[model samples]
Target: MRHQKHIIAVFGGREADQKLLEEAEHFGQLAAEAGWIIICGGKGGIMEAVCRGVDAKGGISVGLLPEAKDIEANEYVGIPLATGLGYARNEVLALACHAACAFGGKYGTLSEIAHALNNQKPVAAVESWKIQGVHECNHAWEAFEWIQTQLK
Candidate 1:
C-alpha cells in the first residue's frame, strides 16, 4: 500500500512563552486542517500547544519522543513513537517531513533547524529568534504558507 506524505514537522523548545504557544497553535490547526500530519517533540511548550490545537481540530499528530523509557509525551499527541536516541532523534523527526516550522526555542530547536536545512528540508520560523539557514517569519500563517509550498 502507498503511504501518504506527511508535510511539516514543528520544532521548538520544550518550554516557550505564551505568545509563542498561541502562534504555534494557530500554525498547527491550519496545517492539520490542510490534511497535514503534525510532528513534534511530544513534550511541553510549543509542542504541547501545537498538539493541542491539532487534537482540537480532529487532526493527526505524531510525536517522536526523545527517550523510550523515561520520556513523557504531551497530552495531545495522537501517535507516539518512542525513540531511545534522546536528542539524536531530533534529526529523525526533522528529516521525516518535507518541511519544518520552528517556534520560539533554544539550542535544541536550533539544532533541529540546522539538521532540516542540511538534510534539504525547507524550514519556516514563526517567532523563533534567529536560527541560521531558516526562512524567518513573524506570522504563523506566513510560515504555514511557505511550508505548503515546500510540500507541493
Candidate 2:
C-alpha cells in the first residue's frame, strides 16, 4: 500500500508582526521537509509566510479561499480552492487536516482550532491560544515537533 500523506492546516491571523511571520515560515519549511502538505486560508500575513516557506522547499501548499475568486489567494499558494464559504470554510480546513498548527491569531483561528479539536484532530499551537486541549508551544519548531509526534 502507498503511504498516506498528512495534511497540515496552518491557521493564523491575516495580519501579523515580523516575528510571527518568521516563525510561521520556519514551521512551514520544517513541515515541507517532512513531506507534509500545507493548507491555509490563502490570504496574507501568516498564511502567505507559510506558503512562501513551503514553496522555497519545493513542497505543495494549498489555499482555501473565502471568496469565489482564486486570485484572492496569496502568490505563494500552489493550489487555490475558491470555496466562497467565508468563515464557514473553517470547517473544511479543520476537517481536512490530519494535524494542525496555529500561530498568533484571532477568533477565526480559535474557531478552526475548536472544529479540529471537536473532530479529535491533534492541534499544536505556537504562541497561540491556551485552550484546554491544545498542545501549546513557545516556538514554531516546538509546534512542529509536537504535531510530528502526534501523527505517529
Q: Model 1 residue 75 lDDT?
A: 85
TM-score of 1: 0.93
lDDT of each: 0.87, 0.94
What local lDDT score does residue 119 receive in model 2, on the 0 to 100 scale? 99
lDDT of 2 by residue, 1-152 (tens): 89999999999999889999999999989989999999999999999999999999999999999999898789999999999899999999999999999999999999999999999999988878899999989899999999999999
Worst 10 residues of 1 by lDDT: 66-75
- Total clashing pairs in model 2: 0
lDDT of 1 by residue, 64-140 (tens): 88888535988898888888888998899878988899998888998888888899998999878575678899988
Instruction: For model 1, name the residue pairs that clash.
Output: none
How close is every model to the real structure, measured as TM-score? 0.93, 0.98
Which ten residues in a row are the worst by lDDT in model 2?
Answer: 124-133
